[model samples]
Target: MSERVMSGSVDGLITLEAADALWADLTADSAVPTASGAFTCSPAHARMGYVLLGGHAVTTVSASGGQWSVLEVEVRRAAAALNSVGMDRRDLVRIGPFRGAPRLECDEETPLRWRQRIAGELQEPGGPGLAARRAAGRPYHLAGIDWRQMLVEQTRDRTQRTWWLPRAVVRLLDAAEHAETQWVQTTRTRQAGAAAAGAPAPRPYNEELRGQLYSVLSRKPGTARKVAGWACAVCRTAPAAVLDHCHEHGYVRAPLCQSCNTQERPDHLYSNDIRVANHYTRLFHTDTDDWLRHWHRCPGCRARTTLPLPHLAAWTAHIACRSLRPTHRAPRGRKPCGVLRVSWTGSQNTPRSCLITVAVDCCPSGEHRVLAQVSYREAAERFRVWLAETAPAVAAAAGPDRLDGLPAQLRPVIADTDGEGLALF
Candidate 1:
C-alpha cells in the first residue's frame, strides 16, 4: 500500500499539500523527492513535515514497538529541514496549522485570537519566536504582505478591513508604533517643562553643539565628530554606539561601540603623543658609551670597565672579569709591545686586578719610551724614595709652594720641613 493509504489510518489527520509545495520550492535546483502524500494529526508530525518541506534532512530518530517506525524518521527529517530554513519548533507551531488551509482568516475574532495565544507561548523573551519570524521566507498574498508594509497599509486603509499577517509581524508593528508614540510624548513633555521654567526652548539635536561636549570630555578636538559613522574606531567591524572621550578632561576621542569602549580603561597622560615621541627618541638615540659605563660596573670590585661591542661578548667578558684575573694576552692573537697586570687592595677589603696593554712607539720623534703599571701602595713608596734621593732637585722642579698638585695617595709620604719630619718606612 502507498504512504497515503497508511496516513488514512490516523484519525483527524490532514493531508500535507503545503509541505509538498515547500519541498518542491526548496529542491528547485536539485532532483525533487517523490511525493509521499503523508498525512499527520500530531503537532510534532506537522512541525516536522513543515521543516522537511523547507529542505533539511532528518538525522535523529527513535523507534518503539520492537520495530523501526518510518513516521519518526520523517518527523526528524522535517525538523532538520525547518532548522535549515531558520524556523525552529516555536515557529513551526505558530504557522503549521495555517499551512494549506482553504481560507486565510487573520481577523480579530478568530485567527487573531488564536495567533495571540500562540505568540504568548512562543514569543516569550529570549525565545526563538523573533528569529523564526525573521527567517520566514518571502511573503505571498495568502500569507499577507511584509509586516512593515502591512503597517503602512493599515494606516492608509481607512475602511478598517482586516488583513492576514503573521503573528510575529503584527507584534513587531505594534511595538514600533508604540515606541514612536512614546518618543513623541517624551519630546513634548520636555518642551513643556522647559517653557514652564521660563527657560528658552530646547534646541533640536542637530542645532545643539555637535562635538563640543565630547571634545571637552575626551581632551580631544571637535574634529573627532567627522569620523562618526556606523563602524567602531577601535575594532572597526562593530557598529558605533557612543562617542568615546576622556573622563577626566571631557575631550572627545573617537567613536566606539559599547564592547570596545568598555574593554579597556583610558591611557595615562604619558601615553600622549608628545611624551611618547620624546621617550622613543631618548631610547633609540642614546650613546653606547654612556650605556656601557652605567651598566658595566664590576659586581665584585665596584670598578667601571669598558664593555665589548656585542651583547653576548660583553656579558661573557664581564663574567670572566668578575670571577678571574685577566691572562694579559691580547684576544684573537693580536700582538702588543707589553701587557701589564697589577693587583691592588679595593675598598671592599679584597685584592682586585686590572690589565693594560701597551703598543710600541713607531715614531722616532716621540720621547716617551715605556709604559709602567703599579699599585697605589707601590707608587706611594716609590715617590718617598725618589723625594729622599733628589730632595733639592724635586724642590726646584716642583717650586717651593706648588706641591699641592700631588696625588692624595702619595702626599703623606712626602715630608714637609714646615710640618713634620720624614720617616722612611
Candidate 2:
C-alpha cells in the first residue's frame, strides 16, 4: 500500500482524505480488482473501525424514470461487487455526492433503500430501525452521481467510547483514492450465501409518518397554502401524537400533542380520582350500549367477552377487576383505592358469579357511587396527560404556529370532535 497519509479540514468539517487514499491503494492491489468498467473510487477510514470509499458511475437509459433506473443498476452492481469481497450493501453506512451529479433524489433514496433492506433482513433481531437511528445520530449519505460511504460491521459493539480514535487518521485515509468504474469477476463463488437471497423491500416508518402527520400539520399556521394545494388528499394518522424516535426500541411513540402537551395517561387521578373520572365522563361520555359497539374488548385478552364480565354490574365491580389483578399491584398514583380484586364462585344452578372489592377506602364520606364505566375519551385524555409529563419537548412543539412551515404531508394528527383531543391513529 502507498505510504501517503491523507488528512486535514477544509472548513470546519473533518476532511476524508485518508479514506479517499485507502480506496485508491486497495483498488490498485491485484487482490481487490475493480470489476466494473465504469465505477471508480478511493478508500479511507471515516471513523474508527468505520471504512469509507468514494466512487461514481454512468448509466444508460432505461424504461423506468431515468434517474431511478441508473440508481437501481448502480446500486445492484455495487452490491454485487461488495459481495465479492465478503461485504454487502448493508455494510454501506452512507453514500453521498462527491464529483459528477447523477440525480437529486438519488442521494435520499440510497440511504433509505439500504436501510429498508437492512431492516427487513435484520427484522428478527429487533434493534433500532435504520431511519430512526440515522435521525437520532447515524450519519449516512449518497450525494448525486458521486457515491461515498462509511461501512461498519453489523455486529460490532459500539458501547465503548470513540475518543481514542483520532479524527485526523480517519480523514487522512479518506482523501487518497479516485478511480473509474470497471467490471471484475463475481466475488461470491458460494451460490447458497445469504447475500444472494432477496426479498421485498421494507417500507420506511418515517415516510409513513410523514404522510399521516399532516392532519395535525394542516392545523399549523404556515401549512394552509400547502393544504390548499393538496386538494385535501391526505389520510392516515399515527396512534401517538408527538412522534419521537425511541433509540432502544427503534419505533417512534406518541410524545405529546402540540395543543395541550398532555400525557396519554392523566395524573389528575392523583389529585382526585373520582373527580377526574367524573370530569372525563362529563366532557365526552359513553354508555354501556356505546361500549357494546365500540370499546368492549379487553385490551388484555383481545377477546370480546364483555357480556360474561360480572364486573360490569357496578363501578366498584369494574374497578375491582382492574385493582385485584396481581400486575395492578403497582399504584399509578394516590387513589381512593390502592387496588381492585375480583373473586368468583360457580354453581350448577347459576353461571359463574363474581364480586369486585376495592383494596382501600371507596370514600371517607361513604357517599353512594353511580353506575358508570370507564370511557374511551377518558382513556385518551389520560394519554394526553401522560405524554405531557413524559415528553415535555414534544409538548412544547405542539403550538399552532410551530407546524406552519411543514408540508401538508408532514402535519400532525388532529382530533375530530370538540375537546376530543389529538387523534394519533
lDDT of candidate 1 over 1-425, digit per residue (tens): 24553463233222344333333333333321222222221111333212112222222122333321233335434534433332111211112112121111222211113233433433356533353354323121111112222221122257442223333343332333233333333455577687786643322122122223342433444333333334565456654445543222222334554444433321111111000112222211332222222122211111112111122112222222223322234667633232212222231112133222122232233332323333333333343343334343322333223334222221111111210100000
CA displacement after TM-score superposition, residue 177 of candidate 1 (Å): 23
* CA lDDT, candidate 2, residue 367: 34
Best by lDDT: 1
The whole-model C-alpha lDDT of candidate 1 against the native structure comes to: 0.29
Assess candidate 2 and give its lDDT: 0.26
What C-alpha lDDT values do all the predictions have? 0.29, 0.26
